[model samples]
Target: MTATDPAMTALAHSWSALSLLHGRIEGSVERALQTEHRLSAREYSLLDVLSRQHDGEGGHLQMRQVADSVVLSQSATTRLVTRLEDRGLLSRYLCPTDRRGIYTDVTDDGLRLLEEARPTHNTALRKALDQAATEPVLAPLVRAVHQLQGDIPRPDDRP
Candidate 1:
């Protein structure tokens, strides 16, 4: 169908609505984390992932793997890792077997900071979602968004 077609118009509106919701929720969470914990949303996300890895074992993921998991570009992830390293939140090391590859792991300080920020981040997100759900016009979209998240597999759930 053409861009101006009714079906296309409806699809565009749907995408726009989803994008707006994402921005709103993300902004709220980011502000809360940054204000209370001095951590950006992306930084908190990376720390959370590394904390999980730390719990599972001492194994660390390569830089590229971290970039993919956190939906960041390689260059951006590299910069972020450098920032976190400077803050004593994480460390990077060359792979023992493959010298070309670099692995990243969360430090004790990173885990502690993540633990401090998690509650703030989660509460902000939940409040935003709950507010949206209370609005009759947005309730269906909110429910759909929640369901979509549930449908996506977590790392451990993947085969």
Candidate 2:
């Protein structure tokens, strides 16, 4: 399609709007988390993801999985994990069954910080969404976001 095609223009506009929405939401949450907990959003996300792991079979995530979940490159995620580990907020250990694999877990301090920062993260997210919803270009995306959340069935709802 030509650069100026109507469909191409529409797609570009949609992508731009989506990017803007993401930037605004992330910026708001980042500021709130940093102010309240001295944590970057990426760090908080890593802590949160690692905290959900369990001793049950298949409960723990691999390093690559953690990277994918946090939307970071493997190297970047490793660096982030190392920083948190140095701060005593996380610990890393070799995988039990696979000597080549490693796993990271959140520490007690990380959990405490996550709990405290949860409210700030959530509040900042809500405020950002509410603000975005007021804009004509972003309102539909915001509604879609809420709709997608509602559409996901809870674990308890699985048959």
lDDT at position 158, candidate 1:
56
Give the distance in Å from residue 18's predicted Cα in candidate 1 to where it truly belongs.
0.7
Instruction: Summarize candidate 1's per-residue lDDT along 1-159 as a digit string, tens digits.
Output: 676999888888878877777888889999999999999999999998777764244467767778998889989999998999999999887877779977788888998999989888878888788787887656788899779766333325556
Name model 2 segments beyond 4 Å from true.
151-159
* CA lDDT scores, all candidates in order: 0.83, 0.91
Candidate 1 ranges with C-alpha deviation above 4 Å: 54-59, 148-159
Cα displacement (angstroms), candidate 1, residue 91, comes to 0.6
| Residue 111, candidate 2: alpha-carbon lDDT | 95
Q: For candidate 2, which ten residues in a row score worst on lDDT?
A: 149-158
